[model samples]
Target: MKKTLLISHNREKLLNALVYFSKSTRFCGKTKLFKLLYFLDFIHFRETGRSITGLNYYAWDKGPVPQDLFHELKQPDTDLKETIALLEQSEDEDYRLCRVIAKKPFDPKYFSRREKKIMEELSFVFKDALAKDMVEITHLSGTPWDKTMKEKGPGKRIDYSLAVDGSKGSLSLEEIKERMSEIKEVTEIFGDQ
Candidate 1:
């Protein structure tokens, strides 16, 4: 028997990822923050069949946006209230860019080794790139966002399944076994209804 895997979303991980990017540059803008997070989650999922942030990425007008995270950022008293305060909004033409404010270093306990590695690597890659460049890169054809945008236009949900589409062999043996065990436990408990 097979069962859907249980997924847990961690706000701490989200904050760590955001802080990692914000720390790498002077002030990571809104678009860059979204794109960085998208990469962090999607790439991690591709390699491990699980996202670090556990966010659902949607094909929005700009690019792949995490709907839940976006909603939380809009709220003022959420767990992310401190993190939200660090974002300084600026109007760039018709777009609003959320620039990051300097804050104390984020605790590292929230991130796994793999998640941390991906975040660092992505931050380095996009260190000097502009937000518009990130948008173009994320919108490349064959990406989940591209496919979703093509089929349903903007504002559609970019299926999470796309992250693992070509990542069957990306996981190490240990990771593969761990995933299998998790699935087995779920199926055993549910027992096919």
Candidate 2:
């Protein structure tokens, strides 16, 4: 069956918050972490109309660097180029650590060993979220596109796909609504299932 996915800014906020908390020293318990990750995967399932793999890829590919980090770097006085260079010099596992330290006003050494350990654990949260996204997308691929022809009619096919573009980071509700309305207009013109 053909389906229409509705994206929501609230859901995106929740996911972003989850990522933030996962990396935070205050909330990195194993049980709570898994629960938050799964909840985010469920949101991805609903918003994109894709299965869990979509959430996995979304988290894996786009989840690491929070949107706020970029915003902070964009400030007029911020030394973005130097900070990026420092991040690049760090090992893969330490990239987020470098980023967190760079964004905050405190010294990097101020983060205790325990806090650093929490950050490492939180990295897995990111990985799991990405894995869920991938699984959902892979499931969708199994649904043959051509089958729509025989099942729904000759012209019936997927008109648009709900793909996540993380390059822009999370969007506001107004932005999402505007895009949804635009898509609704197109669907009306083309006829809907």
Work out the TM-score per prediction.
Answer: 0.77, 0.22
Tens digits of per-residue lDDT, candidate 1, 50-119, equal: 6777678889978999877776666643345555455557567776667865354777877888788888
Candidate with the greatest TM-score versus the true structure: 1
Which one wins on lDDT?
Answer: 1
Candidate 1 overall lDDT versus native: 0.73
Q: Which residue pairs does candidate 1 place in steric collision?
A: none
**Tens digit of lDDT per residue, candidate 2, span 38-123?**
34433333343332212221222222222233344345222333222222223356332222222323233423354334345545
**Model 1: runs farther than 4 Å from truth?**
1-9, 84-96, 165-193
